[model samples]
Target: MKNTVCLIAAASFLCSCGGITERPIGVIYTNAADPIAATASGGSRTGTAEATSYLGLVAVGDSSIEAAKKNGGITSVSSVDTHRKNILGVVTTYTTTVKGN
Candidate 1:
């Protein structure tokens, strides 16, 4: 029973809720952007769609490529990027950026 209890506790603390490929560096704050896609065309226009999460409970927003394109008036997509920010896991925001002409 003691071993089982210890295992459960360890499991709970070891589990994480994230899609990051590598270990996260920021426990208190994190704001970074990563390139996702690229094309041959030179992008002259830019648009961004964002989403936010509160205490990992309520998440709202449209962080989609289509939304970004619509917001930027972009007909041809040349590049795509993703931006993420987390403040002590209490408030988190994600943004999808699309660039096109």
Candidate 2:
């Protein structure tokens, strides 16, 4: 019974992110930058914002389009993209990128 409990906990911890289906999440590491939006015209400027999580307990940072635009000094948003990196389900970082003039 103890062994079964441990296995369940391990499985839950391994798949804690629940984003494995969205993208192939590697148990050891996951680093991907994917485009979430399509654009008609390319942007002249770009900005990025980031958010991070520690052991799915403490999460910090602002990964928002508005924040990205603010940081990049972009007025109009032409396209939006996201970059995600996770390590052993312990540390996770999410970044939002905005492109515009």
Candidate 3:
């Protein structure tokens, strides 16, 4: 019984080490456009979207563009920034931010 308990404890510790973490991967742009032209026409705005899941893989949607469009008068989206975070391979969160005119 003691050996079994020790084995279980070690396994648990190893599993705990296989957890998710968060980092800013990079910036992704759908298209190439003049920076000044992109922000000049309709003014500046930002849209953010986040998704979270527990005990499962969560797929987050890119709602930044839709969010910006909701504000009205958004001519174009300049950039999309994404961040990912996970907890012990059980929970995860994804945040997407869009900036544009």
Using lDDT, give the best candidate's number. 2
Off by over 4 Å in 2: 1-20
TM value for model 3: 0.45
RMSD of each: 3.3, 3.2, 10.3
Q: Write the per-residue lDDT of candidate 1 for residues 1-101, one digit (tens) a residue.
A: 99999999776555553334463535568888888999888888999999999998999999999999999999999999998899988999999999999
Q: Report the poorest 10 consecutive residues by lDDT, candidate 2.
A: 16-25
The per-model lDDT (C-alpha) reads: 0.88, 0.88, 0.52
Find the number of clashing residue pairs for candidate 2: 0
- Per-residue CA lDDT of model 2 for 1-101, tens digit only, reads 99999998888767745654776667788898899886797789989999999998999999999999999999878999999899986999999999988
In angstroms, the error of model 1 at 28 is 2.5
User: In terms of TM-score, which candidate is stronger, 1 or 3?
Assistant: 1
Clash counts for the predictions, in order: 0, 0, 0
Q: What is the clash count of model 1?
A: 0
Instruction: Report the C-alpha lDDT of model 3 over 10-98, residue by residue, as the tens digit.
Output: 87655533343232221221111122123334336776666676666565454354653454444577765665666654666665666
Which residue pairs clash in candidate 1?
none
Candidates 2 and 3: which is better by lDDT? Answer: 2
Q: List the candidates' TM-scores in order.
A: 0.78, 0.77, 0.45
Candidate 3 at residue 64, lDDT? 52
| Shift of residue 23 alpha carbon in model 2, Å | 2.4
